[model samples]
Target: MTPAAPETIAPGVLRLTAPNPGPMTGPGTNSYVVGTGPCVIVDPGVDDDTHLEALVAAAPGAIEAVLVTHAHPDHTGGARRLAARLGVPVRGCDLALAQPYDPDHRVDAPLADGDVLDLGAVTLETVHTPGHAADHLCFFAREARLLLAGDTVMADVTVVILPPDGSMSDYLASIARLQAMPIDAIAPGHGRRLDEPAATLAHIVAHREQREAQVRDALAAGPTTARAIAARLYPDLDPRLTGMAATQVEAHLIRLAENGEAARDGESWRAGN
Candidate 1:
């Protein structure tokens, strides 16, 4: 498939998608340049040299700051290289988020919640929305009511909430925070730009709740490991997708355990209430 070329989706907002594409990353990671004159690049995508060169060429003006949504490779692989090329510091909620796949690639600054970054023509307000990753961040365009959603929300796919670093509670609360915003459009980390922010957010919220219910029903058959639960929930599951389904089940169970409705004993899980 042809990779996404740099295109201006909104006033001063240009999207450049990387070459990496898969079940998880959709049509590769979307790198965005948000503003004119001195602009801010969000999520520099994978570390392929060609992609980096294309990003630099497509940018409308001097790159003032490089912002990362999270530290995941597909989303941040090119950060350090791009930052060095542009002679600008990488910015994100966690400095670590700016580090590319290479350990030597690192962020120059930390962006705290509520911090406002000026991109010359447009202004981006940092919103710390941890869930997809503990250090995930979303940028809100103050005047335009636009959200640079990153992987916190996707166009067609639901984000995976893995354990340890990923939390269902944080993800849900983060979604709630976005739901409270007066958003005009969401430039997601993958797929197409989303309109009808309120409805889309609602659907995402409901989708998780539905997953929780499915997990609960599957548990009605008794205590089981996440893999067994996945088999029960998705009888026709493709072998390739088993890991994804299992991780999602584990995430839901983690939340259920927190709410005192489930318990984990070794590798098995059972309903507590």
Candidate 2:
């Protein structure tokens, strides 16, 4: 299949979609080039030479740094290679948080919330939005009002929040933080850019709340595992997404328990009194 070429989403931002589309990655991972000259590449995508070449080619000027939103393979897999190619530093946060998932994860330049990346015409501030992943981050282009939202929020489907590394409460709080920001557009890790940033963030919060209610109802029935609750809640969920659904359900259960709205009985969960 012919790879899609890079498209400009903002004044100094260009996006190129990687060719690794699947159930988890809608269309494919989005590798963005931010700034006009001496730019930064966000999410280098999978370590495919062709994809790396495409991302480098899409940049309008010298690639200063390779910024990773999270340590997920699809987003950070090619970061090292891309950075090496351009003689730039790989920037991100909390490598240990994602080492279990991506054992080979590494970051030359560690980032924290509020850290700014000044690239001449474009400036991006890192917002530590942990939930989708413990080290997950969203970069805000202050002048353009465009947010480079990783898995923190997607345009098409809800992000899977698995425990140990992910937390439903964290995810919700991250959303709240983003809602409070001055964002006009969102360039997500997957799918297309979101123009109605406020509405999209609001809808995601409402959806999570509704899903939490359903989980509460499911738990009220009796003590059951997260997988069973998932089956009950998503009666027609795609077979391939079964595990992810269960993980999401588990995340909610964990959150409910944290809030004293539910209790865990071994592998099963029951609604709190």
Candidate 2's TM-score: 0.97
Expressed as tens digits, the lDDT of each residue in 1-273 for candidate 2 is 455688989989999998888989999999899987879999988988888898888888888899999988989889988888889999998647733577777889899999998777888899999999999989999889999998898878988898879989999999999999999999999989999999999999999999999999998888889999999888999998999899889999999999998998888889887
Model 1 Cα lDDT, one tens digit per residue, 1-273: 334578887787889889988988898789988888788888989878888877777777888888888878788788888888888899886544332334544558988999997877788899999888788899898777889999999998889887767889899999999998889999999989998899899999999999899888877779899999888777897689999789888989999889998998999998887
Taking all chains together, each candidate's TM-score versus the true structure is 0.93, 0.97
Which residues of candidate 2, in runs, are more than 4 Å off?
none
User: What are the runs in model 1 whose C-alpha is more than 4 Å off?
Assistant: 1-4, 95-105
**lDDT for position 237 in model 2:** 90
Model 2 scores worst on lDDT over the 10 consecutive residues at: 94-103
| Model 1 deviation from native, Cα RMSD in Å | 2.4
- Pairs that clash in candidate 2: none
State residue 214's C-alpha deviation in candidate 1, in Å: 1.3
Best-performing candidate as measured by TM-score: 2
